[model samples]
Target: MGLLDLFIASTIPVLKVLLITALGTFLALDRVDILREDARKHVNNVVFYVFNPALVASKLAETVTYESIVKLWFMPLNILITFIIGSILGWILVQFTRPPPHIRGLIVGCCAAGNLGNMFLIMIPAVCKEKGSPFGAPDVCQSYGLAYVSFSMAIGAIYLWSYVYNIVRASAAGTTIESTRLITGQSSRESSTAELGSCTEPLLPSKEPLASEHRIDQYALPRTKQIEMEDSGNKQLLSKLLGNINWKTVFAPSTTGAIVGFMIGLIPYIRKILIGGDAPLHVIQDTASLLGDGAIPTLTLILGGNLLKGLEGSGMQKSIIVGIMVARYIALPIIGIFIVKVRLGFIPADPLYQFVLLLQFAVPPAMNMGVITQLFGAGETECSVIMLWAYALASISLTLWSTLFMFLI
Candidate 1:
């Protein structure tokens, strides 16, 4: 397709995001104030616990199958690559920007996690319906497209909770620890003074030999005692590692929904009951899907409300915003093209699949980051500011990348 054609194809999807987001921004204004902090929180809770899961489960149960899974095995790995590469880029941005400690994770996350879920689901079908779509007939394109989006959404949620969840959580913990230290007056000056005092009082003349003898005594323990001590240490290490994992996050409601949806999709009897038009329990799927339909608009509204915070002033550095924009928009898209063209030989040569793959890299950061930030109560304002700019600029960035991606594909 020509550049003009590609640009036309790309603009529609970007406009969809823009319009909904603009509506959300409007509702959050002082006069409207429909999506105030408390209102947004309640809506976000619904999206997180209920609507998002229902959307994932209902969509996956409808479209995914054993054959589709095998055919699309490369996708999960592609997304993993996106996350890994984007994270490396995010780290680079963090190093240079040096944002506040609380917002470091937010910056990294906004760079790494694209709006994989809703964007994929929305963009693919919309593109297919267009008259100049490079993908096949609308029905066939949409059928396969929805399946691809469903799998992407499900896996993206898994990675979001598994990887991104911990980053934000750690940022929250680090902020809390620093706050506690400040409250308790544990300044660096005190630590330096203590170290200076210890250094000045030289007591090592006889102590060195005694310390060596003590180390020798520890090594001289009976073989059985040494073995027991090693085993105990190993057990303690294992326990510490296991305890570090947030099981609640690992099995987030959205993740659980994806799991159940996969089971229903892969198993024959369950599929028969839950999927298809004539199925006995198809009503359940329909109901869940109807609720799921609300997720996109509600999420966009929440995002808009959050973005309004940026207008009021978020105290985020301008350099950090520019760094994130560069990482996510300018850098990641180039990397994606290189990966898909040069590195990914195993991916099927399907245009629709290739288009979606390329789009994943070009899209803006996930809106869910805001939700996750809210859940953690750290970096909310800074995150909102970052998101506001990232998404505002997405129209131009996504359009340009989409045009290029379509031409390359």
Candidate 2:
């Protein structure tokens, strides 16, 4: 394919996303009020709990088999490398920017998590359909491309919920702790000041003398006993912390769906019964796919609604936005090209597969990061702002990278 054909192929998908996103933005307007904060929250819940799970499960069950899994073993590793390297870059971005604790997760997440599933789902098929495509016949290319995209989606969901989810959660928790400490410290200082002001004798000392160092030491527990007590307390603290976490959120619906899908896909009996046209239980897969179809559009709309906050002034730093853009677009894609080229020996020789691998590194941050931030009610506005910028720049970046990736493969 010509470079212009590749660029056009890439641009179409981004334009589709932007158009839906624009509609979402319109619906969120005060005049429209269709996707206000409360409405967006409710819709976000549906997407998170329902649409997303259905999509992941159905896609995985339909496309992923044990054989395909074995063939694509290196993909999961490639995706993981993207996350790890992006995360390292994100951490470095955080150190340089020193954003608030709450926004730290959003930043790192934006850097680490690429829109692995959705972007590929849109881009690959579009590329395949192009007249001058390099991935062989359109029908064959799309079939393989979609399967690759589905597997990518399933694996990406697992990582997003497990890794990026926790990063945002921990960052939000840290912010809360910092705020509480600041409040407590301020209150303590206020009480101290008040007490000092009310005191009549400014220079008076206590009648009792302070304890001698030897006396204090004598009252202390034995060293071994103290160590044992400290260990016990630490264990209790760890237990309490563990007990406090919402495991449901950790093993999120999307992750659970991926697991279930894997089980169904890998089990021949289950797959035969539930997945093909001739299956007795094919209705179930069809229904799941029907519901799954809503996931992408709904997610895009919600993303648009959330991004309305950026216009209302999210107070996000320009540098942080630029850093993320640079990391995701410039740094990550370059790193991805190098990694894929180095590991070319282990990967499938299929150019489409190689293209998908490289593309994973080039896509924008996951849209679900906005859903995550909204779920936690931490840095929602800031997330919106970052997503706004990241996706806005995605058009040009994806086009250039897609052209380059195609040329390379």
Candidate 3:
């Protein structure tokens, strides 16, 4: 295909996203008032808890199989590399930009998580349908592309929930603490007092011990006892670390759906029953697919509604936005190309698959970041601002990168 054809193919999907997003923005206008704050929140909840899980489950069940899983193992590694490298870049950007405490996680998340699912779902098939497309015959390309995209979506959900979700959660907690300090001016003192209050026993021991008292001093121990105490302390430290992790977020609805989908896909008996036209249980799959189809358009609309907030001035620094764009669009794509080229020996030789891998690194941040910021009430407006710019530039950046990626492959 010509460079112009590739550019056109790539740009079309982004343009569709933009148009739907614009409609969302319009619906959120004061006069329209259809997708205002409360409405948006309710819609967001449905998308998060319902539409998203259905999409992930249905798509994975349809595409993933034991053989495909083995063949596509490297794609997961590639996705992980994108997140790792993007996170490193985000951290560097955070240090340089020093955004407000609340937005630090938002910035890091926007950098690390790409629109791995939706963008590819749109772009891959569109590219395949292009005349003289480089990947393969359109029918075969479409089938494999869907599988690749579906697998990418499942893996990306895992990383996004476990890694990015917690980062944003931590940032939200820090922002809350910082805000408390600013308001009360005694947050530290109160924390210390709370800690001290937990130890209610008297500093000086009484002559008579209470009925519940063990009458043994914890501090007075033999050398061996001290070693045991140290081991206990280590266990406590490990427990604290584990407790800090948000298991709920780690096994978020989307992640749960992915796991369930994998089970359905990998177990031949289950797959035979659930996935094909001749399956006895195909109705379940059909229903899930119906719900899944709504995920992207709804997400895009929510994205547009959120972007409306940016118009009111989010107080985010221009430099921070620029940094995120540079990391995701400029720095990450270059790094992805290099990574793919270097690992060519291990990577699947299919140019189409290679294109999907490279594209993962090139797309804008996941639309779910807006949902996340809103969920935690941290930097929602600022997230909108960043997304506005990131997506606005995506049209041009994605076109150029898609052209280059195809040309190189």
Query: Which wins on TM-score, candidate 1 or candidate 2?
Result: 1
Per-candidate clashes come to 0, 0, 0
Instruction: Return the TM-score for each candidate structure.
Output: 0.90, 0.88, 0.91
Candidate 1 — which residues are off by over 4 angstroms? 186-232
Report clash pairs, candidate 1.
Answer: none
True-vs-predicted CA distance for residue 229, candidate 1, Å: 5.1
Please report the candidate that would top lDDT against the real structure: 3
RMSD of each candidate?
A: 4.1, 4.2, 4.0
Writing each residue's lDDT as its tens digit, candidate 3 over 123-206 gives: 888888877688889999999999999999999999998899999999999989877878887777898899899988987878
Kindly report the root-mean-square deviation of model 2 from the true structure over all alpha carbons.
4.2
The reply for model 2, stretches above 4 Å from the true place, is 188-246
Better structure of 1 and 2 per lDDT: 2
Span of ten consecutive residues with least summed lDDT in model 3: 211-220
What lDDT would each prediction earn against the true structure? 0.87, 0.89, 0.90
lDDT string, candidate 1, 1-409, tens digits: 5677778888898889889988988999999988889899888999999999999998999888999999889889888988998899889988887778888888888888989998777788888887787787999999999999999999999999888988889888999998888886766778878888889566557444565556544666598678887999999999999998888899998899999899999999999998879999989989999999999888987998999998787777788888889888888888888878875468889888888888888889999999999998898898888888988999899988988888888
Better of 1 and 3 by lDDT: 3
What's the distance in Å from true for residue 170, model 1? 1.2
